[model samples]
Target chain A: MSQDHSLNLKNSHEDPAKATMEGKNKFLGLWFFLGGETVLFASFFATYLSLRESTAGGPTSQELFGLELVFIMTVLLLTSSLTSVYAIYHMKNNNFKKMQLWFGITALLGIAFLACEIYEFAHYIIEYEFTFRSSAFGSAFYTLVGFHGGHVVFGLSWLISLMVRNAKRGLSLYNAPKYNTFAIYWHFIDVVWVFIFTVVYLMGMVS
Target chain B: MTDNTNINKINSYENTRRKEEMKHQVITFVLMIAFTLIAFLVVAAELSRTFVIPFILLLAVVQVGFQFYYFMHMKDKGHEIISSLIFGGIWIAAVTVLTFTTIIWW
Candidate 1:
């Protein structure tokens, strides 16, 4: 343990003044955090996949998922991911104004995506009478996709806060790391959506 | 101190470079959206069940890869170690899901 600490300290010498060791620690810590989040979503995915075939006299993926709407939602979220990339690019360049602009756009896209998702769920519940209580499959499907939607909500809030808090101050070394970390989180969410699209939507529809 | 001044200079240089890179990032972003929309259309159209699902999934995976490597800059800085950790965790989770599915279903 002591040797590891010493090694870390030695390496810290290279970028010592740039980001404090605390910053590195935060980065490392966030990675671990994301690991936990992976497990959480994995469990949800597993449950959804396992219960996927259990239509239970209710709507299955094929019956429920309209490719058109799902496709639109995917486009909205994907565009949001791109906007976030722009935000982070500005962040790296220390272009605070541009970063804020891009971040704001990203947040708006996220909001649009979330609104679509909510409407989709409402359509599911109202039209099909398929809901969390309808069947085990319904429960699993809603829980998995709804959990992701929840994350999008949280991410939008986080983006908004970062944008508002740092708007006037501009990007400092301190705030730069904050935006950097936020970008990491946002991209991770996008990654999970990719898997959800594949396993939950595509596979569910087919199998 | 000279060190502080030098650090400031380096930061300013990085700032300028990042600004220049923003355009490229936006371009990449646009491409990603296009790819995603195309994949969605392919899936929705139900071009061919056997081929289409896998193909769209593959496209989605590629887009995710682009988001990770380019937008997140996972290729730069200390990202290797963190990314590996993430991948490792994913592998384990995947295996666990496979095992559970086999046990429960079979």
Candidate 2:
């Protein structure tokens, strides 16, 4: 029933070192978040793999996939991941202008990637006649990849908000952690796309 | 009064140092992008799906490692316990998925 003095004491003595410690905690917490996201995608992937062959008279991965476009989209997302790194780099250096510039680039690349993905999905649905209801394989495939695309959309929004909010203020201990956390999330999204390219596209095409 | 002035000077110096370290974070970020793009190209080319799939995944895994250790500072001493717990959760999730799929299908 007694109030906790230790917690209050720590808060009262908050120094730069303490701020750094808090940043580390935020980073670790985000990692745990990404871990859960990994499992979420894993389940979708397993389901997709299981149903990959059940084309149900629909076009198969080999029949539908064109490597050239997927390749370009992949490049865009990957580059965005890199740009976000640059943003974070500027963040650490206390260079707010440079951080905003790089984050802007990252967000632009993410949008481009999303556009390509949407186009690709539309092509599949309209041209290839690959609807989610086409088969179990179709359902799982769209669910998994679509979920990732959704994450990209969400990330784009987050990046935009961060950029707009911090456009004038510049980097602070407060915003630096936000930028850092966003980078982690962006990288995690990129990582998931990697698995998707492998398990969903590559494996589907080959086997 | 002298001690207080010294403390402020040291604090400013530390702030500058921290900024420099953050600048170095750019290198790791660029490397992550390069790895990601290459993996994308490899997978997209449809180059020996058998090898490329695992290779691309491996590249991705490496990128994740960079984000964790460098950007996320997983190597920081204070985060050891939390990191282990996170890895533990991933392990459990992996096992559960594998078990369910294998048991039900096979």
- The digit string of per-residue lDDT tens for model 2 on A107-205 reads 889989998999999999999899999998899889999999999999889889888987887655556667788887997788787777756765666
Best-fitting candidate, scored by DockQ: 1
Clashing residue pairs, backbone N/CA/C < 3 A, model 1: A93-B18
Q: Quality of candidate 1's docking, in CAPRI categories?
A: acceptable
Could you tell me the TM-score of candidate 2?
0.79
- The Cα local distance difference test for each model comes to 0.76, 0.74
- What TM-score would you give candidate 1 relative to the actual structure? 0.84
Per-residue alpha-carbon lDDT of model 1 for A1-207, expressed as tens digits? 234443232222232213555557777778888888888888888888788888888888888887767767777777777777777665555567888998898888888889889999999999999999999899999999999999999998998998888778866655666776777788888888878877787666663
Q: What share of the true interface contacts does candidate 1 keep?
A: 0.56
Docking class of 2: acceptable
Task: Give Cα distance to truth, residue B99, candidate 2, Å.
Answer: 2.2
In Å, residue B21's CA in model 2 sits off its true spot by 6.2
